[model samples]
Target chain A: MPNCDKVTALVSASLDHSLPLHKRLAVRLHFLICVWCQRYLTQVRFLREAVREHPERLESAESPSSTALSPGARERIGQALRDDRR
Target chain B: MAGNLSDPQTWLEQHGDYLYRCAMLRVRDATVAEEMVQETFLAALQAKDRFAGQSSERSWLVGIMKHKVVDHFRKSVREQPVSDVELMNDEFTGLFDKDGHWKIETTGPKEWMDPSSALDKAQFWQVLRRCLDGLPPRTSRVFALREIDDMPSEEICAAMKLTKSNLWVMLHRARTHLRSCLEQNYQGLTT
Candidate 1:
C-alpha cells in the first residue's frame, strides 16, 4: 500500500506523465480511500489548468506584475537584433 | 512572403514582446529573457528559408526561444543547493502526517466554486502567475519548462543537468506549493 506521503508525491509526478503504470495503479488505489489526497490531486490539476490558460503577458514597464521586464532591457535586445541584421 | 517572416521590423513589432514574455517566464530574469528573445529573432532570420509555412509565426519564434532557454540553463548548471533538498523535505512533511496519511480535516477539499469559469477568467491567471512567481526560482523554472512548455522529461533533465529523481522531487514541491497557493489566494474569486 502506497502511503499518503508517497501517494501525494506520485500525484505530482502523474501530472508530468512521469509515473509508471504500476505506481499509477497504486496511486489510484490509494485515492479510493483518501479524500484528502483526492482533493490534493484536484487542486494540482486545477493549478495546471489555470496556468495553462494564463495568457503570457507582454513585458511592460508600468505593469505591476512580477513577470514584467524593464523597457531598457527590451530596447537593448531590439538593438542587438538590429545589429545582427546589419 | 505569405507571412511576416521576411520582415525583421514587423517580426519585432508583432512578436518581440510576446516572445520576451515566454522567455521571461521560463528563465525568470530580465537580462536573460531579453537575450533569448534577441537570439530567437536572429535564429528565425537565419532559418527563414526553412519556415515551411507550418506553425504560426509566433510559435516558430517561440520554438527558437525554447532552445535558447534550454541553452541558457545548460550553460549555468550549478551544484544543487542543500536548501532545495531541505525545502522539498519540509513541503513533503507538511502535506502528510506521521502515519503517512493526510491530516484529514485540514486537507479536505473545499468547493472550488465553478472552477472552469474561474480558470477562464484573466484575474485567475494573474493570481496563478503570481503564485508561480512565488515558488523558488529553480523549482519554478522546472515546473514552467515541464508544465507550461510541455517539454519532455528527458530533454529537461539533459538541458538542466538534473537527475531524474531531483527533477521529480522539484516538480512535486512546485505542484504542492502551487496548489496550496491557489487554494488560499483564489478560492475567494471562484464562482
Candidate 2:
C-alpha cells in the first residue's frame, strides 16, 4: 500500500492527468483507510474548482489602489498609441 | 468596418483598469501587468482593421492580453536558466515520516469544514491571493497559467519548454502549498 506521503503526491498529480492503473489503485486503497488523505484530496479539488470557476474573485479581492494601472503608465501607453496613429 | 470596434484613443479610459486588473490577477506584478495591457492595446490598434466584432471589444482586448501574458511566460522561461533545484526541493518532505505517512502531529492535513462555502467569502479570496503570492515566482506563474488561464498541459510544456513530468511536479508543488496555506489561514476565519 502506498503511504500517505506518496498517496498525497499522486492525489495532486491525479488532478493534472489520470494516473496509470496501478498508481490509481494505490491512491484508492490509501484513501479507504486514510481520512487525512481524503480531506487533502477534497480540499485540493475544491481549491482547483474555486480558482477555475471564479478567477475574478481574486482580482476583485485585490486592493484597487495597488493593482490598478498608474497614471504614468496610462499616459505612456496613450502616447504610444497616438504615435502609432501618426 | 462592419464591427463595433471602439476607437483606439478611448481604450485607456475605457478598458485600461479592467485589463490591468485582469493581467494583475494572472501575472501578480504591477509593472508587468501594465506592460501587458499596453502591449495588448497596441496590438489591438494594429489589428483593429481585422476586428470582426465577433465578441465585445473588451473581450477582444482581453484575448490579446492573454497572448501577451503567455508570451511573457515564454520569454521569461527562455531567459532564465532552467534549473531543477527548486522543483526537486520537495519542501513538504518534512510533513511526511520515514515510512512515508503524514507526521500527523506537526504537519498533517487539517480537516476543513464546508470548504466550498469559503469561496463565497471575500476574506477567503484575500487569503488565497496572499497564499499564491507566497509561492515561488515560477511555480506561481505555472499554476496561474494552468489554473487561471486554463491552458492545457501540452501547451504549457511547449511555452515553458518543460517536459510533461516537470510541469506536473511544479503544479503539484504549487497546489500542495496553496492547499495547505488556505487550510491554515482560511480555516482560522471560520472559527
Candidate 3:
C-alpha cells in the first residue's frame, strides 16, 4: 500500500502523463479510504482546468501598468520597426 | 485584399500591451518578455505577405509570439547549465512524516467547496497569480511551460534537458504548492 504522500505525487504525475497500471491502482485504492488525497486530486485538476481554460483571466486581473510594455521598450521597438522599413 | 496588412504603425499602440502581457506570463522576465514582443512584431512585419487573414491580427501576433518564446527558452537552455538543486531539494519533506502520511495538522489538503465558481471571480485569478509568483522561479517556469503554454512533457524534457522523471517531480511540486496556496488564499474570497 503506497502512502498518501506517494499517492499524491502519482496523482499529480497522472495529469502530465498516464501512470503505470500498478501505480494507478495504488492511487485509486488509496483514494478509496483517504478523503484528503481525493481532495488533492480534485484541487489539482481544477487548478489545471482553471489555468488552462482561462489564461486571459490573468490578464484581466492584473493591473495594466505592471505587465504593460515600458515607455522605453515601446519606443525602442517602434524605432526598430521604422528602421526596418527604411 | 490579398496583400492587405493591418497598419504596422498602429500595432504598438493597439496590440503592444496585450502581446507584452502574454510574453511576460510565459517567460516571467520583464526584459526578455519585452525583447520577445519586439521580435514577434519584427518577424510578423517581415512575414506580412504570409498572413492569410484566417485569424485576427491579435491572434496572428500571439501565434508568432508563442514560437518566439519557445525559441528563447531553447536558446537559454543551451547556454546555461540547468541547476537541479531546487528540483532535488524535496521541499515537501515537512508535509509528510517518516511513515509517509500527510502531517495533517499543517499540511493536509483542505476541502475547497465550489472551487469552480471561484474561477468566475476576478479576485480568484488575482490570488492564483500571486500563488504562481510565490513558486521558486524554476518551478514556476516549468509549470507555466507545461500548463500555460500547453507544451508536451517530452518536448519540455528535450528543451530543458531534463530527464522525464525530473520533469515529473518539478510539475508535481508545482501543482501541490499551487493547490495549497490557492486553497488557503482563495478560500477567503469565496466565502
TM-score of each: 0.83, 0.86, 0.90
- Output the worst ten-in-a-row residue range by lDDT, candidate 3 chain B: B79-88
Evaluated at residue B63, the lDDT of candidate 3 is 87
Q: How accurate is candidate 2 locally (lDDT)?
A: 0.81
Tens digits of lDDT, candidate 1, A1-86: 98888888888888766678899899889888877788778878876665554535322211243444467866776787779878
Across B1-191, the per-residue lDDT of candidate 2 in tens digits comes to 63698677888999888888878767768888888988998899889889988888877888899899999878876635446555646667767888988878767787776777777888899888888877776788889888877899999988888888888888888888888787777765335
lDDT of 1 at A62: 19
Give one digit per residue, the lDDT tens place, for model 3 in B50-137.
Answer: 8998888888898899899888888887534445566535567777889999878778887776777777888888888878777776
Candidate 2 deviant stretches above 4 angstroms: A63-66, B1-7, B48-57, B79-85, B88-90, B188-191
Full candidate order by DockQ, most accurate first: 3, 2, 1
lDDT of prediction 3: 0.82
Docking class of 1: acceptable
Q: Rank the candidates by TM-score, best first.
A: 3, 2, 1
Q: Where does candidate 1 clash, by residue pair? A: none
Native contacts, share recovered per candidate: 0.48, 0.74, 0.73
* Cα shift from native, residue B58, model 2 (Å): 3.6
Which candidate comes out best when scored by lDDT? 3
Write one digit per residue (lDDT tens) for candidate 1, span B124-175. 6666677777777788899888877778888988887888888888888888
What range of 10 consecutive residues in model 2 chain A has the weakest lDDT sum? A59-68
Quality of candidate 3's docking, in CAPRI categories? medium
**Separate DockQ for every predicted complex:** 0.47, 0.65, 0.66
